[model samples]
Target: MSMRTYVTWAEMITGFARSGDSVSARRFFDQVPTELKNVVTWTVMVDGYCSNGQMEMAREVFEAMPRRNFFVWSSMICGYCKIGDVEEAKAIFDRIPVRNLVNWNSMIAGYAQNGFCQEALKAFGNMQAQGFEPDEFTVVSVLSACAQSGLLDVGKDIHNMLSHKRIKLNQIVLNALVDMYAKCGDLINARLIFEEMTERNSACWNAMISSMAVHGQCKEALELFCRMEKSNEKPDEITFLSVLSACAHGGLVDEGMEVFSKMQKKYGLEAGIKHYGCLVDLLGRAGRLREAYALVKSMPMKPNDMVWGAMLGACRIYMDMEITEQVAEDISTLNSSIQSGNNSHYVLLSNIYAASDRWEKAERTRIEMENEGFQKIPAHSAFMPCGA
Candidate 1:
């Protein structure tokens, strides 16, 4: 290889950056002659750092760059957003002297991914106001925000806009539409869009099936899963998750067991903790507390709060003080390892202890809960029968 044909510094930097070896990427950047350094080189390094989650280092490189381009600025925004720092991403987005499609898309995605659905919708409106059209990515992100936030009208408008503009619906876009409608409690529209899709992916099927399951249409959800299996498209773990959830919700214990076996025996996918949690919940609901407890004890991995919580709920069902105490202890151990809503577990355990004639222990548990700044939430009940 002649020196004349040496790979350009830009190419080397980009390769290293993309490969996630920020250390090597930075070293290559350092060796480049200062005068030889261009915007591409700087952007590549910053992008590498950001992609590898070295946000602070990315900022350092970004600040030191003599000149910055749209990509560099946009990448920084994306990096902050990727790390769930939407506020900072938004601030940078606002400062861009000349915003482009990429910048707007990043901001919209950031807000949507971080659960700032209202902000995402507002950004979408702003993008349109600035004469920028929504591409598939933009459409998907906005649709997701709408789906999660229950902005059904906005989601429908987006669907209508695609039709009016004669935009082609790809698999991902179609999946998003289906998901949005389903999650917004518009299963009829979801089914309509799903039927219209010329092409479908597992996500599209899973979304519709999950929608059915969510709405207590487990039988129909199972039918869809069977249809998917009949086709060439293989069910992924997420697909099985929906299937199992449907079985659990419908109280189809035998079916849930069969599907659970198929997930590993036929599909060759290992059961994750989430699947076990669902199974335990199903058993708990079916009054199979002993089986649920045995399953939890036999788990290959450490049971999380959700799994123990399910068993605890089962103990509450059976009113087995000894087993309830054991599950309560596991939940207490999980409280230190997982950061989630453990108040229900604590309260249930306290109540169980009190009911089981363990008054002193119940008081101690209540005191521990108070030390953790939790109070017994007052139970309230009412019936509107109709929607409020």
Candidate 2:
């Protein structure tokens, strides 16, 4: 092939790498002889492996690169950070001879995305100290980290900082701020931000409604759904999911049914499994186990584990031994391994039988949990770290 042919092939190979197809990238890279295997070509291979989550392979490629540039080093840092290895990513970041804004932003985003909230906040602080003014990317990632780790004080501080910096409040930033406040149990301030936003999109409305739903303001969430319906922004299936979830939590059975009906009939939105699960939860909360079961049976798509789990939970709450047995048997048949491993179903079933003085059945359930090797999780758990 001529030099022009090599350039065209190089572009094609790099395109594969850029899109995370390392297998194909390597295959194409092998076609190039040693003489034409430029630094850019090798760096693309490194990026490809990194994007595909093969950090070791990325490292190998990086080491082999005769001339590594900023992009090559930064991609490795990002890969390490992407996989929750912040210490390694930071090591690479420290070695960058002359880091630019993109490099800084990548580090901040990496820490935040991997649940290293404090590290992300520290990076933001460090960036400002180095005389680099934060753009929208920096602020947004920090806001998300604050939201994830429930750093309410830190989140509030960031909000204040954004205001202090006179940053234009984009719709996404507003949504993130609203989500942070809601997650922090500060609905009053979340609502204030929502109401103050100049423009609202589907995502923004969904966030506000979801926040209200999660924070026990179910009625307010439904009201926001109504407001979304009336506005120019059309409520998608997710909007209905949020609304249905609100009704389920609040025990608005009638309202839940109406919304479920209208979502299909009026808005032309098809109910997904999550929507069905939420409706099941709504019915179950209202002490309508049979109705919930009928609805589950009526679903076009087979109800998933969550839908069955909801039914099992409901049967437990109502202390319906017969229904619990029936549902438990159904669940065991459909997803035996999953139901066996899940403590919620087993514990709830055992307690239901125990409440009715069926001590033998309850004991058997506990024994089953032991036999199935699901007693390892210790019955209750939280995924977050201490101090987040």
Candidate 3:
């Protein structure tokens, strides 16, 4: 190919990377002359593959490169992290000749994303020990890990670092901070950050609203959501889920329904299984069992385990054996087809049988679950430490 043609292909590959079209990027890459495939081109392709969840393909490109630089290694590690392969990310990290802030950030992000909050913090500590300063991405990753693990003290320390260092909070960092405080049950700090943000994007609003909701501050969450509307910011599916969950927790049935309807009509966002689950919970809590059942039945998509579990809970409350049996059947069918659905269905069905004084049936369900080697474990959150 002529130099002009090669340059055009390279530019096309850059466009594909910018647009997150990894497939097209690879297609364009294949047309590049072997002699003309520079490190920059390979880095772009690696990044595009990572962003598009093609981590293995990214690895192939990374390995095939004539020479690998820090950026190339960081790109592959970040890709592995993005796909929740923390171990693979760490392996890449282990091989890097020199680790930069970007390298540490990738590992920190990987640990945080994989629910290793403590690990992420440890990684930050190690990064500092190696004479590297924590940047915005570092702070964001650690704060997110704190949020997931509810480590208030660690979160507070990070907050202090940000303030002492005078690190201006960008939207992403600010959102992570808000989430951390909220999960740690410090709504005051969460609110302070939320109010102090100079430019609040939709994600900022969603994080604040979600933090409030999860912390049981439904009234405050609702108020903030309304304020978001007044600010003319459009709510996404996540925002609606958080707001509806708040209403459901507070038993604000009317408000929940209004929000649910608004999500569909105003935002043009279709209600997914999660939204339906929240609505069902709201209606079930209000003793509108029949209405909840009808809503579940009328859903355009198939009701998942969560929906049936909510319905079954309501049936147990109302002692409605007929619908309980129907829900049990649905649960069983769902279990037979989908592997992950089995535990929740079995648990719900056992609870339903137990509530109705059908001890024998409940016992049978337990035995069956045990025979299938389905043991439900209590959920626990942990933080892992990542190192530079």
User: Would you give me the overall lDDT of model 2?
Assistant: 0.82
Candidate 3 is scored at a TM of 0.87
The local lDDT score (0 to 100) that residue 66 gets in candidate 2 is 80
Return the candidate ranking by lDDT, descending: 1, 2, 3
lDDT head-to-head 1 vs 2, winner: 1
Candidate 3's residue-wise lDDT over 179-260, tens digit each? Answer: 8898889989888888887888888898888877877888988999999988967899999989988898788899999999
C-alpha root-mean-square deviation, each candidate: 4.2, 4.9, 5.8
Model 2 C-alpha lDDT per residue in residues 61-172, reported as the tens digit of each score: 7887788777887799889988889899998889888888788989999998888888899999999999898877888889889888878998898888887788878877
Which number leads on TM-score?
Answer: 1
Error of 3 at 125 (Å): 0.9
Tell me, by lDDT, which candidate is best: 1
Ranking by TM-score: 1, 3, 2
**Model 1 weakest 10-residue run by lDDT:** 378-387
